[model samples]
Target: MTRDTQGENAPSDLDLTRLLQTLTVESDRYAERFGSRHGLHRTDVNALALILAAARRGEPMSPSALARELGLSPSATTALIDRLEAVGHVERERPSGDRRRVALHVPEAGLEEGRKMFVPLAEAFADSWAGFGPAEREVVARFLDVSTEAMKAVSAEWAPPHESQRRR
Candidate 1:
């Protein structure tokens, strides 16, 4: 298929690849800075940050939902949740009429403990983007959104169904 070369669709795979790599490195630097404060592994801190952010956003996502959203396998998600729970960052709960379902909630300790480290790191990155003009920022944002959607589609096709469910 011939590619469009004018505007939004003009970027080639090479352009997208380079942008992805740049974003990954920048994000990792932020994550590493944030992780250093917690004495937790990078993945653990990232997972907790995700869960806490979702909780604060009123998403209150289940472990299965988190695994799907984060593109993590069920076992990996469970382990991540376990670590958070152990650290008093989250609580595992089963509300009435939902005996088999587990929901994760952010505890006060998690918020108080992690926010000092995480918030500043996030703000630093946000501040860096503040220099972009509106148009430039919009272009970058759209590219990221589209790229994310493309990965979601591709991952959905390949993710194992058996591993999709919350682990026992």
Candidate 2:
């Protein structure tokens, strides 16, 4: 019986770990370059990116909703929204139905930046995915979804005992 060379010659788990670390460092460098071009700290850029994406969803934006999406505290989310407002990247409006609630909407400038950052990311992912058929794409998507959920479960289960203290 002949054995497959691919399985026989596969790198060990440690090699995969090193490979992932290298990829993460490269990805961070890319994000840093993009962030520098936009004159934003990485976190600020990420917050603005999320806000613009939510606006594109065609639903009224709620600060609470954004907070939920980002896994951020309400106060932190408010602070982020405030920063965006101060920078003229976003504005708040009181919808007619709810005077007490504020809705976040991105200004044209914010949308433009979001577009600039998202275009390349989207294009790169699409280009890489072009090699996959529908079945393969579906399998990959399902695996990613399951992996994400599993990681979330593990994180939640092992919640740090002093997470709040550590944040300060």
Candidate 3:
């Protein structure tokens, strides 16, 4: 039996955590650089990406959610949303139950434009992934799924008590 860093004979999530942190840093840098090439501000590009992601996941994107995800002030998020809306990248619709809340949707044109800009990078990733066998890819997929769940759980349960107040 092998021992992990804790010196106990057990498997651990430490590897996953380290890999995730490195991947997040490099991926964000790549996204920022690539988005800059397309003439969009990094934060604006990040917001657009988030909104698109939410739509793809069949979840609604509201300004509040975007703010938390992007770590932006509410006013900053509103401004970012306003810019996206003005450029036809996103459209804000008031949800039926809450007129005060804005639900964001990406226009088809925006998706098309994003695809045009990101396809080359996606192709590069596909080429890199080509080395992985099906079994390896499946394991990676499972790891990512579990990692995402872990992140969601911690985010929900472990924030500082004054964190929200500090923002206000």
Candidate 4:
């Protein structure tokens, strides 16, 4: 296999790829445990995370947007939203002038719940990288940003068109 090598001591592309895969598996395992403890499915946890992130960015997501992000069918997305709503983790609101435009929100309680579940993990991550200097942290951050974009591009290319797309 063709490999991109930086130096004799530096990790090759294959090594980096394998490391990323391992990291993903470990991260998923953590999510699974959190989901179990919270009585949520892994998908539910993922959905909540997306919603929370969007809210933080001042761009609350609609159900359709969440469905696209999750690669879930409309019906399945609705069901997932219903489950979250039942558990008091999500709320649907019509905050726009157009009454039909519904936005997903994580209530204050839900936000606190998420913080309680994840802040320690975030702290642990921060602690792990505490030794890295400014330049090293910049390089690491750039690598992650590029890697995320590349993964998203590949996922978009491989994913089948959602129902909304197909209808257009």
Which is the winner by TM-score between candidate 1 and candidate 2? Answer: 2
TM-score of each: 0.65, 0.66, 0.70, 0.88
- Best-to-worst order by TM-score is 4, 3, 2, 1
By TM-score, how accurate is candidate 1? 0.65
lDDT for each residue of candidate 2 in 1-168, tens digit (9 for 90 to 100)? 333446876556566456656766887887788778866677666666676667677777788877765667778888888877887777999999879998888878877876787688889989988999999999878956775686678776665545434446
Among all candidates shown, the one with the greatest lDDT: 4
Error of 3 at 139 (Å): 1.2
CA shift of 95, model 4, Å: 0.4
Off by over 4 Å in 1: 1-13, 32-39, 67-79, 96-100, 157-168
| Model 3 Cα lDDT, one tens digit per residue, 86-149 | 7778898988988888898888988888888689888988999999999999998998899899
Worst 10 residues of 2 by lDDT: 158-167
TM-score pick, better of 2 and 4:
4
- The alpha-carbon root-mean-square deviation between model 3 and the true structure, to one decimal in Å, is 4.6
In order of lDDT, best first, we have: 4, 3, 1, 2
Residues 10-34, model 4: lDDT tens digits? 7778878888889989999988987
Task: Give per-residue CA lDDT, model 1, range 1-168, as digits (tens).
Answer: 234465555666777687787978988887787667665678777677677778778776689887866667888989888887877777988868979988888788878876776678779879998889999989988978998898778877776766555332
lDDT at 69 for candidate 1? Answer: 68
